[model samples]
Structures are given as structure tokens and as C-alpha cells.
Target: MAQLLACFRRRGGATASAPDEAAEDQQQAAPGPVLVELFSSQGCATSPEADAVAARLAQDSTGEGAVVVLGFHVDYWDYRGWKDPFASSAWTVRQKAYVEALRLDTLFTPQVVVQGRAHCVGTEQDALAQAVRDAPRYPAPAMKVTFQRPNPTTLQASFTGSLRSRVEGPGGASVLVALYENGLVTDCGRGENKGKSLLNDHVVRRLEKVAAVREGASARKTVSGTVQFPLWDGFRATRCGLALFVQNAALQVLGVQHFDLPDNV
Candidate 1:
């Protein structure tokens, strides 16, 4: 087992750039907590209950700041009933990759992957909230990420931050770049869920870990990267947005935010 470090912030606070402010205009925005990622689909009737539970968790930022919630709409359920408008193959691939990387046997919907190392049923609120509270508080990552939005579909991000190993720990970490989208809608047509309309927030469309931060004795460090949107059928690039976060190798979330969409994807 990898040794977990202490890099968590005592307080829950995040800074946003101009693009973040713009994205906030569309809907309510919050910062990172124990990042609870829900892999769900609009076509699954069981998802709404899980989604509701996740949404409530997202709202609770009091005890441990704010619980950052991200919904990754997966396309695996599309053939059952209604094809979820937000579902994407890329999102599905990301989930599968995590399974392989983490060495898991099975994967399913309404699955809540906490931080990156923990998994729980999405509808289980009590266990979920408690897990968030118990999560380790590792030191922040090596980069502080911020986004610049020239338009509604394009985003330019800057990562200038530092990561410190725990009092006596490993000297290296991985920084993940994830593009989170919010304010999504989907109509249920065929799967386990049919004839139902749905609204989603903080949904991750694409997730790619762009870099790994090597901890050093230095006081500060930095890295840079960019995420571009891909055009999909019935999915307009405008209503969608992005978020970038840097996490350690143990999958502990350190930094996160909603990236403003530039004019062009």
C-alpha cells in the first residue's frame, strides 16, 4: 500500500478566475471537499435517488468546508431506455481506466468514487458523508490552477502552486486535470428510466491526469496544461463548462474549480 501523506488544508477555500465567475452565473458553484464522483446515467431509474443523495452531499460544506460533487454521465445505459444527453464515451473510458488502474473487478452505475481510492453506493448518504469527514487532509498540490475564459466555449488555465510531502513521507505525487461540466439536461426514453426529464450539475465530461508533481524540499513548484471541448451530437458546447483539479498519487483531492467556457471549444 502507498503511504498516505498529510497535505490537506485545514480550511476549505478556493480561488476562481474570471472564467469561474462567468460559469457561476449559470448556476450555484462550490469548492472541493471530499470530491464525490458519481458515475450515473439518466436512463437508469435508480440514478435519480443516487443523484439526489449526491446533490445533498454537494450542498454540505459546513463541517469540512464544501463537499465537492462531480457527476460523470456514462453512456453505458443509453441502449436500455432514454439516451442521456450528457452521457459520453470519454467519461465511460475514464471510469474504466480507473477500474483497471485501481485493480477492481466490477463497475456499476450510481457508483460514487470518493477522492479516487474509495468507492460507495451513490444513494448511501450517511456512509458517504462520514467517509468525507474521515478522509485524509494531505498538503495541497504543487500548483494552484485558475482558468481564463475569453468566450463561452474556450478556456485557458494557469497552474502555479506548490506541493509539500507530509512531515516525513514520499517525495512525489500525481496531478490530475479534469474538465467538469455543469447545468446539463437529459430526457429519459428507454432504459430502466423512461419518460422522465432530468437536470444535472457538476457533471464531468472528460477527465485526464495531465501531470505528476514530484515533491521537493522547495517551497513552491508549478505545471501547465489545457482542456479542449469536443463536439458531440445534441450536445451544444456552450451550456457545458470545465473544472481543473490537482490530486496526489493516493487519489486525495488537493485543488479544484469550475473552468469558464471560452467562446470556442
Candidate 2:
């Protein structure tokens, strides 16, 4: 893990390119959170193994500032036999964008994309392990956000974060916050698995970008905004979380953070 982290340290490109105090400050301000995204479907028999990988990574997300997992059930495979209740066309579109971004020839089930930069077969445990360890090359803006459930169905959020002027470049930056669900199970009736049941974690329910960051002319740039989400009965029994990430307009993830929802609240 240390070796992987060393590889991402700003040497020439993403890391500290200049041997100066300003460059060192930029490196220190970058938040180090890894990201793991799994493109899967209920109809794909191999997807369960990938799903398990995501769940395991999410478990570590809190411990080592490890990979923040997101399991996206795409709708393309719904026609195979049993429709994935969690599958969404929007999710499929997101996957497609990755297809272009990552330079993949096409899409496939059980594909694990790490840090939105590297990818491997989800079931390839060894490769996936290395990918997760190697994430965090792109420095994230330092950020903080809190979720408050005002009532049973509505959630209000307050966010505060600072972006380094060096990291955002001249175009500016933005952060995407998402409400995700976990420990979700679905019993497949007529798909490839027939009678099998599927359990998943880090399933995204809703996501939106905060307003464009406030790019200050000084060394310390920042942004702020408020957003809300409507909770429903479908989220009643499961564990949920809020994840926030900063990214440039080019679609590269800069930094990320995740907050698990409390049942007592």
C-alpha cells in the first residue's frame, strides 16, 4: 500500500511538479480518498462476485480511507430475463460515459472501475486489490458536509469546502454529492440465477453537483451550497450514506468523502 501511494505522489504530473513551498502546500491540502465503481446487473451470473468485492471494499472505506464503493446496476441486462429492480437507464448512461473516458472498446457486466481512472474485471480480486491501493493520485479539495434529517422523509445537508487554486486550474471546479444505499437484497425470480437472491452495497439512489465552486483570485479558493434529498420507504431497512467528491470539468475526480447514515436518526 505504501508503495502504491508513493507511485501517485506528485512526481512530475499530478503530483508536486515544482520543488517549492507553494507546490508542497498543494500536495498537503489534497484529500486522499479512493473510489471504486462496479458496473453490474442482476441478470449477469458473474455479477454477484463483483458485488461482493464492492461490499468488502466499502467495509474498508472507513478504516484506511480506502475505496468509496458504488455499485451501479445497469438496465441493459434487464431484458435478459429478470429485470434488475435497481437498474437504471441513467446509470447505464453513466457507465457509457466511462466507456468513452476509460477507452474501453465496449461495456461488460461485473466491470470494476477504480478511481474513475483505471479498471479491471470485478471478479479479478488480485488486480482489483492493486487498483484500489493505487487510487488517490488525483488530489481532492479539502471538504466537509453534514446531513440532517429534519423529518422522516426529508434530508437537509450543509456543506463547506476549500479548493486550492493550483488544483482547479483556470476553468474552475465542482463537487458531486450522492445519497447511496447499502446492505440491499433482492430475490431474483427469472433471471440467469432464477431463484437466487442478490445483496449489494453502496448503491447510488440520488446524486447532484453542488453549484460551481467560488474560485478566489488568491491562493485559497472555495465553494459552498445546500441540497436536499427525499427519503422513501424503499430506504427503510437498509444502511445509507452520503458521498461527496470534487472534480474538474474534464470529468476527472479530484477528491472524495463518504458519510454513513445513522439508524438512530
Cα RMSD for predicted model 2: 7.9
Model 2, 94-173: lDDT tens digits are 88888998888999999988777789999898899888777665444445555567888877676765544344445656
Model 1 lDDT per residue over 51-77, tens place = 888766655454334555788888998
Best TM-score goes to which candidate? 2
Candidate 2 weakest ten by summed lDDT: 9-18
Q: Which segments of candidate 2 are over 4 A away from where they belong?
A: 1-31, 61-65, 138-141, 149-152, 164-171, 214-219, 263-265
CA lDDT for candidate 2: 0.69
| TM-scores of the candidates in the order shown | 0.70, 0.79
State the displacement of the C-alpha of residue 68, model 1, in Å, after optimal TM-score superposition: 1.3
**In model 1, which runs have C-alpha deviations exceeding 4 angstroms?**
1-32, 100-103, 139-153, 164-172, 208-210, 215-219, 230-242, 248-265
Clashes of 1: 30
